[model samples]
Target: MYIPAAFRSDDPDLAWQLVEDIRFGCLISGGLGLMASHLPFMVERGDAVRLVGHVARANPQWKELEASPVLVNFLGPNTHISPSWYTTSPRAPTWNYVAVQVRGRVRVTEDRETLRRMVLDLSALMEPDGSPWEAAKLDIAYIDKLLPGIVGFAIEVDHVDVQLRLSQQNNADDQRKVRAALGAGSLRERQVAETMTRYLGRLPE
Candidate 1:
């Protein structure tokens, strides 16, 4: 979470967007020797924002949520930037990526209703539009039976760190070259390229 001044993203809205856009993230409990769980998260914004998710009840990580400070890490599009792609000489290979880190204390819930609601909301977030399968369609009895096996939790955010390392340190020419190289690569790379254009503004071709 070390962010240089050049790479630091101070925009809260953009950070929230990243968390929502990439809903899947790692929930880490530092109160438990840094134990971690991979989970899908939902952003609850209001007077106080919250990060919500669930884990298997048997997962020991849940015990740590209330006992210690927690962190949620979300990674967006990323790509390797080869030194060869830079217009500037002597530049070493590096990465172009978007990452968000949230730190806070957590609150866990065992209520069946809350768990059910969390599941339904998560399914809606994950499912593509017009998909036939839906959580609401599942039998309530079955859902209730299954709910006992899981635990739902929410993290009240203490702080957030957003890093957008999109070659902001590079000169425009080198950045443009990196963007062009990224544009020619995978979907993720193309996403990085697109972000560069959007955030850094249009440059001379």
Candidate 2:
């Protein structure tokens, strides 16, 4: 999260969009000697910004939240930029990517209704065209039986850090070369290239 001024993104809306686009993240807590859980998050924006997610009851990471704040890491498209791709010599190889880190206070909720809502909302987010499998379609008895196996939680965000290291420090020619190299590669590489082109406007119009 050590973002240089040139790489830092001060736009909260952009950060939120990144979080939503890449819903899966690592939730980390240090009170229990550094415990982390990879979970798919659902963001809520309103009077108080919150991240809602659930962890398996068997996973002890949620238990540590009681003693510590959590850091959620949302990593977007990334690629390795070779020095050879640059227009000039004497350039060091580096990485280009977009990432957002959210620091927040977490609260574990065990309420059955809340857990059910969280699950439904998460399903909606994951599904291609909204989930056809609504909780209302499921048997209440089955849902009740499954509720005890998981723990729902919400994190009230304290701060957010967004970084887009897309060769902003490079000159226009070098950046264009990097973008071309990346876009000519795999699908993921192409995505990183597109993001750089879109956000930094380094590519010619």
**CA lDDT of every candidate:** 0.87, 0.87
lDDT per residue (tens digit) for residues 1-205 in model 2: 7988888877887878889988999999998788888889999999889999999999988788878888999998999999999878898889999899999998999999999888877776687766566555777788788889999999999899998899888888998889999999999899999888777853222
Task: Give lDDT tens digits, candidate 1, residues 1-205.
Answer: 8988788877788889889887889998877577988999999999988999999999998987899888889988888889999866887878988889999889999998899999888888889998999888888898888899999999999899988888888887888889998999999889999888776542121
TM-score of 1: 0.92
Candidate 2: misplaced stretches above 4 Å? 130-136, 201-205
Which residue segments of model 1 deviate by more than 4 Å? 201-205
Using alpha carbons, what is the TM-score of model 2?
0.91
lDDT score for residue 77 of model 2: 92
Candidate 1: residue 129 lDDT (0-100): 92
Cα-based RMSD of candidate 2: 2.7
